[model samples]
Target: TQPIIVTTTTAPQQGGSGSGQQGGNGSGSGQQGGAQDLKEVLNSKVSKWGDANGDGGVDMGDVVLIMQSLANPNKYSLKDAGAFNADVSEAGGGITANDALTIQKYLLGSVTKLPESYAENIKTVTAPATTTRATTTTAKPTTTTKATTKAPSQASGQKFSVKNGQNQFKGDSDGYSYEIWLDQTGGSGSMTLGNGGTFDTEWSAQVSKGNFLARRGMDFDRTKKATDVGKITLDYAADYSASSQGNSRLCVYGWMTDPLVEYYIIEDWVNWCPQPQGGSKTVTIDGAQYEIFTLDHYGPTILDNQSRNFKQYFSVRKSKRTSGSITVSDHFKAWADAGWNIGNLTEVALNVEGWESSGKANVSKLTIDVSGGGQGGNTQQGGNTQQGGNTQQGGAQVQAGKKLCAISFDDGASAQSTSDPGYRIINALAENNMTATFFNVGSWIKTEQQIKYEYQKGMEVANHTQTHPHLGQLGSGQVRSEWEQCNSKLKSIIGAEPSHLMRLPYLESNGTVQSALYDVPLISCAIDTKDWNNASTNDIVNTIKQAAQNGSLEGAIVLCHENYATTAAAMEQVLPWLAQNGYQNVNISDMAKAHGKTLAGGQVHTRA
Candidate 1:
């Protein structure tokens, strides 16, 4: 059991030692005291699943109680078994901020159940009788420590103050050491490196609220082949103010000496860097998703007069998790499979990089498990050797000799149809195992949940103007307003901005419209179903069938309206025909990628 300290202001009553004392009623029955004792015992047992106050429910109130205890350990207490219940981590250690985060994740629906121990203990506990108590109030505890600590000192010119022992490099503060001497922005924090021998190192840090507290962990030798070094695992706990507007990250860093490239696997919140080359692909490892990116560095210098020519690879986690273990080798394998020549490993490090943020983090363990011997194979040289393979396919490349087609529905959630055309269209596409793009009108969105359902079902929800206006005639301001309103609505509904693909009303676009769009790509279809004109279902089907036979449908973006019942009827046949004809029905984004193109800002795209 963890230690529990209880503080009281009033002195204990005389003649009562761990026994019942006479109250204002002047009565102290032995049976009444026994019942009270039983209630306390039951409360202690019931509190073991994040119910810190023993109120029989794990909610925000319990979270607040735990925070209070952390803030003032002496004045406030977990009280009996509250500490055990609060240990939500799998480690089953004492209560920490990670336990609070686990409870938060449970409340947020990210996690469906508490830790295993909490469930196991709750199943065996028995309930106690309830009792009513007289009203009483206690004074608030005095503030001994501020909720936020002051930023650390930053007069030290180094990124982090280093204390170099015989075989150790320890950091005295959280700082940054850039290859180029950029203007310094001052901030303060502290970190430590332990077991800092020549080959092994451990790092931990507590960053008091500040701005741009970027620091690197100690570097480990990376002279051996990657296969020989089986895996590197990082066990860590991190917490930051959710209200903070800046970015904070904990990531593993690898540097290759030959190509002078750096690879980073990062878990970040808010903070970001420019990826001029853009993201390549997303890979899932250990059930966590990561977005990979590569970029060439164009800096003035590389660590004080070193070469500035280098490349960078970043694998950023899709979601922020406060506590977990990362298998570094799996990420490397993903990049290697994607044609990234990782080259010979030279230095490996874990870093806590922060920018304009206030937070704290702890790394409990860092272990590198090595297996196998160096096979004595010649090291693959050059920066571009690993840049082959199926990297393009991992993003959106279509197989050679295979044609790509995109099916798109416009003006979604229309009120004209007898049934939900969006639902029916999605069902047809899903049955065929295909994905399409939907251009939604903001006003037509009856409920955000409907849009969420479409997005969740693997359909791309894009912007069609707020009221489906003709951008060719609308002024620049109106065009911006129309695009912004629709994008904002989609973001609010689906928790992300719509894919930067928009279609002009009636396909009416001009230079003015194009300039107004700025960065958003204009999506024009290769084949027009003309279902908006109330074409017969057979006519719609025949148009697509003829296009496919004539080879016009190959690498084509087909346009149909979700508001029309004929379009939905047409897709019931068109999707199966495309699948049968050796065509892969993909979204516009995928189709663009298949053709070695990006569906990004300022580009007008049409099907081949």
Candidate 2:
């Protein structure tokens, strides 16, 4: 049993003792009342999931403590007992900002339970009884240490310090790799790396100065392309302020090798920012609009100090924000669609850069997750990468314990007809509260409205080749052309390709087809309903049921053709049966994520 420790301002009563027990309330009930002079003698127990401050409540105060512990562990680190209590993750890992995020979700009613469901063996105690004398009680308000800590003294012997002239520092900070580059000719710049991927920096005005940038992410040797690294997503939080004069940019900055290009997804800036010129475009990402600018630069880059002609790409946000998530791959796709070439990645980092500006910035949280960029690996630091809340499909939460399966329809022929097989299939799936994927051919989709109707029903539309050619007989160039044509048509209609998935005509994939589309995951199927072979509706239904009886339907990718009326008729019976048996019909992407599997590039996936 764990003893309940209480801090009180008023003196204990002078009688023998008063004993009482109360149910655990997470409303800061352990604190002594300020006006009433009632001492909160906590005689209750709580699980160790979220009570970070040891105050006997899982409330905002606990959340603040967990965040503080991550931001500045030197002074606010939870030691021994507090450390054990702060391990709130369901995985029972060490303390991180994710633990605090989980507690915040719970306090905000986003989650009903903490990761740990077991009750702690906390012991409770009673206080001494009433005294006759009047006592003044002063309540101590919970305070969280701010992220902006003063610059460390030289005696601390931490790492890099602000100085004049060019200085580049590289090492690990709070379990994350970081690099700091200061090119100040006369100004002053200070940097301090903190716990759990946090950084604090300050700078003074300087003339004839380059720029100061502190970053946390990859500083590669220009050997790997962005695709070689996989999909990169960044989650960041910071407090940024700068003077009106001089230029400053808070962004995700990187460089490319072969093309010798530089890029910036500028989230916030001070005073002025780069603007899009002629032939430039705009793309919306993470709920904000950004103007894409392409221009030439003839100067030294991070990779090469010699003068060279290169390109600089900018996705400067029209409006600014200090905290949010960025799906970096979406920007890559948008740039690629606009006929701009991106090359081998040299650096991908969250940068706080100032050009002769005087200001301070504190990045309290930073996390980058790179997964499924054909590298077939996942890297996460300083946080939990799993998305918060239950697994979601079609924007609705899937109930716990239900098995998930992806149902796909192929060959989108005559999808615009009112009697279109896709319409019936979509209606049937919707009636049963499910969704499926439709592999569409470019030419067979008669109108954009046909694709829009499918999307309106929460159905995913994927690529099935432009003309549905036999892919095994095609050369690598031909296969790529087919894929590109289909994707181009889909993007023009839907504003984006359906997913990173493509199905071959007749499922006739060979080495050439695989080699040509090495960056896309070819989706195959485990169960073929064969509804397109003039099979009766009962035959299609029984094929699926037999697979379920054999225990092969769980997490399986089931295939059917969208050109057949019999397939739609069969799904009327098949979808309801699956739902009744505790199975959820999801698209391929959702099923892959649900089963802890990644649909990596250059691979063929039959089941999740």
lDDT of each prediction vs. the true structure?
0.51, 0.59
The sequence of per-residue lDDT tens digits that candidate 2 reaches over residues 1-608 is 01111122222212221222112111122244442222122212223656664433455445544554454332233422344465555222345566676676775578787663321322222221111101101111101111122233221223344443324444433334455556636576666766545677777654666567676654332324555556777788989988776778889987765566888989999988887666778788878898887988786554212356889988988889999998876787778778888775545568888887778888887766655542211221111111111111242334457777777888774566767777888788778777677788987777688677766666666788899887878888999999889878876776644655786576555556765775566777656776756779999989888877767677777878877778888888889998888887867765654453445333445665
Model 2 misplaced stretches (Cα beyond 4 Å): 1-397
Which model scores highest in TM-score?
Answer: 2
TM-score of each: 0.37, 0.41
Q: Give me the overall lDDT of model 1.
A: 0.51
Model 2, C-alpha of 554: deviation from truth (Å):
1.9
Candidate 1 has which clashing residue pairs, if any?
48-85, 159-175, 159-176, 212-356, 247-271, 339-386, 519-601
In model 1, the worst 10-residue window by lDDT is 128-137
